[model samples]
Target: MDAIFIQILNGLDKGGAYALIALGLTLVFGTLGVVNFAHGALFMLGAFCAVTTQKLLTISKHVQDTSITFFDAYKDQPYLEIWWGDFGRTIIDWSVPLSILLTIPAMLLIGLSMERGLIRHFYKRSHAEQILMTFGLAIVLQEIIRSIFGANPIPTPAPDIIAGSAPIGALFGLDEALVYPWWRLIYLLFSIITVSGVFAFLQLTTFGMVVRAGMHDRETVGLLGINVERRFTVVFGLAAVVTGLAGAMYAPILSPDYHMGMDFLVLSFIVVVVGGMGSLRGAVAAGFLLGLLQSFASMNEVKTIIPGIDQIIIYLVAVVIILVRPRGLMGRKGVMED
Candidate 1:
C-alpha cells in the first residue's frame, strides 16, 4: 500500500513535467497551425537559464593561498561571498528559484526571435518542412548549448531547506515510511498553478479569447481588423515561455544537459498526440494518464508479468488510444484531421 501510494505520487510528479511541455506544444499547434519540433530546445534553454543565473551569482576571484598548498595556488572565492558574506551565500543557495525571473525574459526574447526570424517564413509550409526545419533548428540549438556549456549534465539542486524528503503518508494516518521529495511536491504544485493559470487566461481574459478565436477562425478574426498574426506571434512566444519555465523549475529534478531537449521531445510529442493534437485539456489529461501507467508499469510485480513494460508502456498506450479514437480523447473534428 505504501509503495502504491508513493508510485502514484511519483507518476503525478513525472506527469507534471510531461503536461507542462505538452501544454506548450498544444499552444503553438493550436494557435499557429505549425508543428514545432524545436519546442524541446526551448525547454533546454530554460534549464540553461537557471544554470546561467547560478554562474552569474557565483562569479569568483582567485586568491593565492600558500598555507593551503605547498606551492602557491589560488583558491576561488565567489564575488558574492566576498561582498555580502552570508547574504551572498543565501542568494547563491537560492539560485534555482531566483533564476525563474531571469528565465522569463530570456525565453520570451528567444521565442519571439525564433518566430519572427525563422518560423514566420515557414508558416504556410507543409508539416514535413516544418518538422525538418524545426528539427534541424533543435539540433543547432543543442550544438550551441553544447559548445557553451559542454555535453555533460550540470547539477542544479533544490534549496537546502526543502532538499530533504517529506513524510506525506502521515497526512493519511499511514506510517511515516512513505516519504517523498519536497522539491517534487513543490514542482507538482507549480505545475497545477501554471496549468490553471493558462486555462484561466484562455477562458476568462479578452486577450486569451482573441487568441482562441484566432485558433478557430483565424481568417474571420483577421477580417474583423484584429492583428491575428501579431497575436499568434505572442502566443508562440508564450508557448516557448511555458516550456522554458517548466525546464527551469525542473533543473533540480533532472540535471540540465545539451541532449535533455531531445530526450523529452519524443515523449512530449507522444503526449500531445495521445491528448489530441490541438486540445490543451487533452494534453494535460493524457500526460498524467500515461505518467501513471508508466509509474505502475515499473513495479517489480508488473514488470515480472510483462517484461520491460516500464520502458514501453507509454508507447503501447499511445497505439491503443490512437486505434480506438483516431481523433484522440478530445480532439476537434477538423483541427488536425486533414
Candidate 2:
C-alpha cells in the first residue's frame, strides 16, 4: 500500500510537468492555429533562466588555499556570500524560486518576438509549413543554447529548506516509508494553481471570452472589429510564459541541458494528441493519465512482467487511444477533420 501510494505521488509529480507543458502547447494551437514546435525551446530557455540566476548570484572569486602547501588549489568564494554574508547566501540558495521573475519577462519577450516576428507570417500557411519552420526555429534555438551553455547537463537544485523529502506517510497516517520530495509536492501544487489560473482567466475575463470566441470562429470575431490577431499574439506569449514556468520549476528534478527541451517536446506533442488537438481540459487530463500509467509501468513488478514497459507505456497508450478515438479523448467534432 505504501509503495502504491508513493507511486501515486510520483505519478502526480510527473503528471504536473506533462500537463503544464501540454497545456501551453494546446493553448498556442487553439489560439494561433500554428503548430509551435519551438515551444519546447522556450521551456529549455526557462530552465536556463534558473541556471543563469544561480550563476549570477554565485559569481565568485577564487581564493588560494594556503594550507595546501603540497599542491596549489583554489576555492570559489561567491560575491554574494562575500558581500551580504548570510543574506546573500540566502538569496543564492533561493535562486530557483527567484528565477521565476526573470523567467516571466524573458519568456514573455521571447514569445512575443517569435509571434510577431515569425509566427504571424505563417498564420494562414499549411500545418506542414508551420511544423517545418517552427522545427527549424527550435533547432536554431537549441544550437544557440548549446553554443552558450555547452552540451553537458547543468544541475539546478531546489532551495535548501525544501530540498529534502517530506514525511507524507506520517501526515497521512500511512506507513512511515511513504515519503516524497517536498519540491515535487510543491511542483504539483504549483501546476494545479497555474492550470486553474489559466482556465479562470480564459473563462472569466472578457479578453478570454473573446479569445475563446475567436478560437471557434476567427473570421467572425475579426469581422466584429475585435482584433483577434493581436489577442492571439498575446495568447502566444502567455503560452510561452506557462511553458517556461514548467521548465524552470522542473530544473531541480531533472538537470537542465540543451537537448532536454527536444526530449520533452515529443512526449508533450503526444500528450496533446492524446488529449485532443486543441482541447485544454483534454490536454491536462491526458497528461496526468499518461503520467500515472507511466509511473505504474515503471514498477519492478510490472517491469518484470513486461520488460521496458515504462519506457513504452506512454506511446502504447497513445496509439491505443488514437485507434479507439480518432479525434482523441476529448477532441471536438470538426478538429482536424478537414
**Winning candidate number (TM-score):** 1
TM-score of each: 0.96, 0.96
| Superposition error at 40 for model 1 (Å) | 1.1
Superposition error at 22 for model 1 (Å): 0.2
Span of 10 residues, lowest total lDDT, candidate 1:
63-72
Residue 68 error, candidate 2, Å = 7.1
Error of 2 at 281 (Å): 0.5
Residue runs of model 2 more than 4 Å from their true location after superposition: 64-74
> Whole-model lDDT for model 2 versus the true structure?
0.92
Measured by TM-score, how close is model 2 to the native structure?
A: 0.96
Candidate 1 error regions (>4 Å): 64-73
Clashing pairs in 1: none
Question: Mind giving the per-residue lDDT tens digits that candidate 2 earns over 292-312?
Answer: 999999999999999999999
